[model samples]
Target: MKIFLLTEAGKNIGSGHITRCIALSQAFIEKGLYPYFVINGDNSVKDLFKDKKYIIFNWLEERKRLFNLIKTSDIVIIDSYLADNTLYKGISENAKLCVYIDDNKRIDYPKGILVNGGIYSLKLKYPKKRNLIYLLGFQYTILRKEFWYVGKKKVKKNIKDVMITFGGADTKNITTKVLRLLTNEFPNFNKKVVIGKWFRNFNLIKKQKDERTEFIEWADANKMKELMMKSDIVVSAGGQALFEFAQVGLPVIIIAANDKNQLKNINEWKKTGFIEYAGLWKDKNLENSLLNKINFVNNYNTRLQMSYNGKRILKKNGSLNVVSKILQELTNKE
Candidate 1:
């Protein structure tokens, strides 16, 4: 069966969603199913689909062309919030539409599936919507293959080399702020700052580099996963990294970078205990609070408990499973 997968990625949003989509697309390839992508533009994530041709439609004209293309494909799965109800309505009438969501924004989408693979299990109560499947929880969290390979580590006191990663682009520059505050507050600890490719404060981050602080300019998901495995403690923004950190059994300090739907997801996940909040930019004393999280999660006893808890809560290699199930359901409908 043919599928049109719509997702957006760039230096702006860190390409996590699109990257996960690639993992899902890989499952389609294994099953000999066709998965065509519709990307906002060419990106690092798009490289995953070397064999697939993705259609490029500007946001304004996207609605018109996407529906026309959906009519031809057996299933339409969008991993973006950019696609609205009008697009869903047209696709719902003509083809099976499955939406991937992490944002808490409510929608009147019908005749499709709403899928969220966040760390915390999700639940959406729509008003008697028909044929709607809300695939909630972390068992369905979509992540790249590298993160699933759990690694060995030694978190002996200050031996825990903390690797703190915000998203690819710190639009708010939280990483820089966190690092600055951490060094002064927790002089006993060592750190590895994953300065994302698009981080604006390169000069500031580079200047702060020392023996205790190892600054990484950029590392692909594979390398980043290895770094995360090596670290005993992690303090990062709550995005795709939150799930990856959890999957690796790293105790994390989850800070919300953006103030919208992603923020809502972070809030929900905070209650689960696997991830604890470090507060966003608004809090008066966020830096000290973050230091506390580092100290708390870094403990041998706490870290051991978190590792055991992570194994119980998260599914192993969920991308292939989720993609396969969605594809199977769509083909069965045909």
Candidate 2:
């Protein structure tokens, strides 16, 4: 079967959609199906599955190309939240089967299946007659094969290495504010800052070359996971990085830097005591909540509980499996 996967990747969009789609793509390959990615250009994900089948197009001008790809494709998988009515209509009409991976509740998904592979996504309800396959909740979150294979070592044996990853770039330099707060607290701890190449304030982060921290830029997938596995504490965004942390059993602080959406997720995670959040765009009580979590990171019980919670959510790497089932059903539907 020929599958066309539509996703956006890069500095502007972040890597969650593309990364998860690739994981599903791998499963398709394992089953001897041909999966070709139709992505928006210039992203770390482009290099990740470099040898895999793909054709990049500009998101703004891909309607013609999209319908054309859909015509030739036996199946079309969409992972873009920003895809509007026009785009969705065209792709759904042309492809024999169209599977959409979505999280937002606002979209009108009148055709095909809407797969939401996150825990919070469960709250989103869909219309009954739309032929939708809502794969809601973390039970379907996707992670690459490496995350699944990266063995978890004992916490005590792991170095006191802390990882700071905000979306490949915080257009707002939220990383700077986070680093400022964390540097003083963990003065002697081994720290690494992932400064994304596509980051808007690349120069500012590059200048943060100090003795207390290791600076990594445009890092490869292997190295990124290595640091995540080795780290004792992680201050990261609530996107794909969360899955990596969950896979390796690392204690983390969710940084809802980019938008309010991450903040909503952070609050939900907080209720479970799994991870702590530090919203970059704070109003008044920034010092209290932010520092408190940093302090909690040092406590034994808090850290252990967080690690255990990571494992609880870890069972959800069913993205590949779930998508495969959905596709099989969609193809057999009529």
Candidate 3:
């Protein structure tokens, strides 16, 4: 079967959607299916699909062409916020099977399979429609293979190392602000910052580097897991990193990123006692607020409990589960 992933990635859009698509694509590959990406993204996004089969379409200028190409797919799965109801309807009418990987029920979706992989997905009220299969909550969280088999992290008593990441595109440069404050105030703690391709403040971040600070760029899933495993605590933008950290059983402080969907996901996950919620980056007192949360979660008991609770809530079999269901549906069609 040919599975086509309809998604976008780049500096403006961020990488969460494409990242999850890649994870799902890998699942499809393991089932002996070839996956193709239909992308509307920047050069950085092109680099990401260098090893895969993909085609570029300018969604703005080539709507007819894009829809025409999508109509030929066996299974078309969309994971983009930019796609409107018109696009969704077109895909639903054309494809043999249409699946939407949604975080929030923001659109008036047509008849199709809806998958919400967020921790708070169960609480969402999706519109009832015929021929719609809802795969909600943790059972469908599509994490990469590297994050799947991670051994739970061992949090140290005194917090020796802290890993800071703000998603694929830290557009507002939150990492720089947090890193500066962290390096100046808490020089004793070993700091590791994961810089993505879209980070604009790399030069500025480089200036803040000290013996205790290290920067990691273009981290594949394995490198990401390694860094998370080594750290005692993590300060991250509330994106896919939150779920991965939760799976690894690392105590986390979530600073809201630019994505509205991610902000919602983070706020919901914060209620579970697994993550400490720092205010959004736009807040005037974000640095101080984040520092306070960091200090608050530094205790051995707090870290240990957070780790324990996170592990208890997250399941690592989501990719396999989702794949099995999709394959089953496809098999029945025959």
Candidate 4:
């Protein structure tokens, strides 16, 4: 079967969409199917596709080339924030089996499968239609293969290590701000800061790096899982990484960094008792909110409960579940 995964990522666009798509692609590879990635992104994304089959181009602008490439594809999965109705329609008409990975029902998607693996996806109330096959909620959450079967996290009594990640781009430079805050307020705690490839504010972050701060640059999924396992808690952006944290049972303080739409997911995860919502990045009181939450999470009982809630809420087999469904659908179509 010819499978093509369409997505975009860059310094400006962030890497959430591409990251999740990579998870899904890994699922396909597990099933002995190699999927080609058609990305409209920058060079920073190349590191993610080391051994994978992919081509980089501006699919949004060169629609003709994209359509030509996917015209004969048996399955086409598109995850993007920039694709419009017409573009979706074109892919739907061309591919034998079309899958639209959604977050907020961004558009009236063309006929095919609609996969919204967000924790709050069902709450969005996607319209029921005969043409659409709905794969909603956390059961379909696309986690990286490394996170698919992680053992339970060991929550420490005292918060010695803290991991901070703000997506691949850290477009709003939240990592630097959070690192600075931690360096000043919690000097004793070891800080594992993930520095993305597109981090333009690395100089600022480097300046704030103290004896307790460890800078991790462009960590792969396995390395990320390792860092999460070692950390007592994580301060992260509201993105695909939340599900991974949940899978590993890491207590999280979530900040809505670049995307306001993340507020819904952040609020939902907060309700689960696993994550503390630290408000949006643009908020004047965000730093205060984060500090307060960090102090609250310092209690051993609170961290334990957060860890328990997170492990209970998410299973480590979400990516496999999604793959099973997609393959089943394909067989049915045949």
RMSD (Cα, Å) for all candidates, in order, is 2.9, 2.4, 1.6, 1.2
Best candidate, lDDT: 4
lDDT over C-alpha atoms for residue 268 of model 1: 68
Range of the 10 consecutive residues with the lowest summed lDDT in candidate 4: 313-322
Please give the TM-score that candidate 2 achieves against the real structure: 0.90
lDDT of 2 by residue, 152-224 (tens): 5467533367788876556657677666666666667677888775677766665544578787876666887
Q: What TM-score would each prediction reach against the true structure?
A: 0.86, 0.90, 0.95, 0.97
| Runs with alpha carbons beyond 4 Å of true place in candidate 1 | 42-52, 94-99, 119-121, 149-154, 262-264
Q: Model 3, stretches more than 4 Å misplaced?
A: none
The stretch of ten residues in a row with the least summed lDDT in candidate 3 is 58-67
* Cα lDDT of model 4 by residue, 106-217, tens digit: 9998788898888889899888889889998878888888887878678889999999998777878888889889999999999999988778888988998999899999
User: Candidate 1, residues 32-54: lDDT per residue as tens digits?
Assistant: 77688887754555454567768
Per-residue lDDT of model 3, residues 1-334, tens digit only: 6688888888887788889999998888777887889888866678788789998776645778876776776788889888888878877887888889987787988776788878778888887787888888888888887777777577788999999988788888888888888898899989999998788789998988889998999788889889888998988887777778888898898888765667767768878889998888889998899889988988899999999888877655787788888777666656
Name the weakest run of 10 consecutive residues (lDDT summed) in model 1: 119-128
| lDDT of residue 120 for candidate 4 | 86
